[model samples]
Target: MSNRGGVVKTLFKRDFVYTFYSWGFYVVLFAAFMISSFILKNFLDGIREEDILVSAYPLNYPLFISVIVISIYLVMLSGVSISREREHGTLEVLFYGPVTAGNFLISKYFKDLCLGIIALAFCAVYFYLVSLTTNLGFTAGLVRALVMGVFMISCVVCFGLFISSLTGRTRSSVLVLLAILGGFLALQFVHAALIGMEREALSTPMLYLRETVSHLFRGINWVSPFAFLNRGLDAVVLDSPLLFGLNIFYAVVYSVIFLILSIISMSLKGVKA
Candidate 1:
């Protein structure tokens, strides 16, 4: 038991150090903050033009934008981690030690989660400074959103890890990951377009298609990590403690299930491409 614990610790420390120190992580973080700064600049400009600002959660949108940016980079990184290691033969070499698929993947999972937390910390600092300089006031809602972001990033990490375990090559992992995410995005766009139009104005075929896409979109609420993000953010906006807590619980379940699935996949697939 102690040996397994030590193995997890060693692997996690190595991965955490390598990734946390890498320029890629900070580069992605800088891009996220830059986009948030742009959005906030526009927001401030609008407020100045109007001479007044009235909103309960002014910083929430910028926070969400930043979170999305971080999630995208983290997702791609997680997606390629397992496959890249396998393709390069590092995974097999590591497994010759005390490492099993379980410890290896768990280390990778926790490493990404820690990275997300660090990214979120940067976001908190950025938003707080923005509030201080602009007098926009960093509301509690922003803090709440940041908290929810932890769970959101967890789901995203697990989702990407699951994809990583399924494919054996970096190219395949990336292609598959993008295709699945793109399909989710397309479904969302179609559902929104349909819902926005008057039902009575739609033709019969269009109505049927809308029904199909709506079902798919609703099903994606369980599978798509971004769906969890949207739902979690909504819980924060609604200020319903019960709903907020429930969604967090759901996110935990989602992560656990995906984590188990990824482990099983790695075990079955082995550490070779």
Candidate 2:
């Protein structure tokens, strides 16, 4: 047990350092902060003097968006990590040591999770600075959303690992992930549009199509990590303890299931192509 722990820790440290030293990490942070700041500025500017916006957590939405932007980069990083290791023969070399498929995948997951938490810390600092300048009102809700962000990022990491385990090349892994996620998002949007339209205006074929898309969107909501994040954030916004707890539970289950699948896939596929 101690040996396994040491192996995981060593790999975790190695991956963490690699991720921290990478230029992409800093770029992701900068992009997330800039986008959040831009959105906040626009939101503040839209407020008229006579109009009052009474909200418990104004920054939560921006925080959610920022976390999501960071998540995209982190997920891709996680996917690339495994495929790069395998392609470069590092994974095969590491497997000669005490490392197993589970150990490797768990270490990658933890490294990415730690990075996500660090990103959330950076997010906290960013929001604090924004509050100092703009008074955006960082409430308890934002804190809850950040906490939820950690779990959401776990889901993303595990899902990325799952995709990485299936593909031998980093580019292929990323392309596959992008295609699937894009399909889910596209379906979601189309379903939402159909729902917003007047039902009477739709032809029978269109109605059937809308129903099919709606069903597909609902299924994707359970399968996609982004959907879990959105649901968790929505629960935070609504301040529903029950929904929040449920979402958290769902995220944990999602992460665990995908992590197991990733391990199994890696084991079956072997360390090297």
Which candidate leads in lDDT?
Answer: 1
* Model 1 global lDDT (CA atoms, 0 to 1): 0.94
Minimum summed lDDT over a 10-residue window in model 2 is located at 46-55
What TM-score does each of the candidates earn? Answer: 0.97, 0.96
Candidate 2 vs. true structure, TM-score: 0.96
Task: Give each model's whole-structure lDDT.
Answer: 0.94, 0.90
Model 1: colliding residue pairs = none
* N/CA/C clash count, model 1: 0
Sequence-dependent TM-score of model 1: 0.97
Each candidate's root-mean-square deviation in Å?
1.1, 1.4
Tens digits of per-residue lDDT, candidate 2, 1-273, equal 698898999999988998899898999999999998888877787665536675668798789889999899988988777888899999999999889998888899999999999999999999988888877677888889999999999999998999999988888888998998898888888988999999999999999999998888888889999999989999998999999999989999999999999999999888885
Tens-digit per-residue lDDT, 116-200, candidate 1: 9999999999999999998888888889999999999999999999999999999999999999999999899989999998999
At residue 93, candidate 1 shows an lDDT of 99
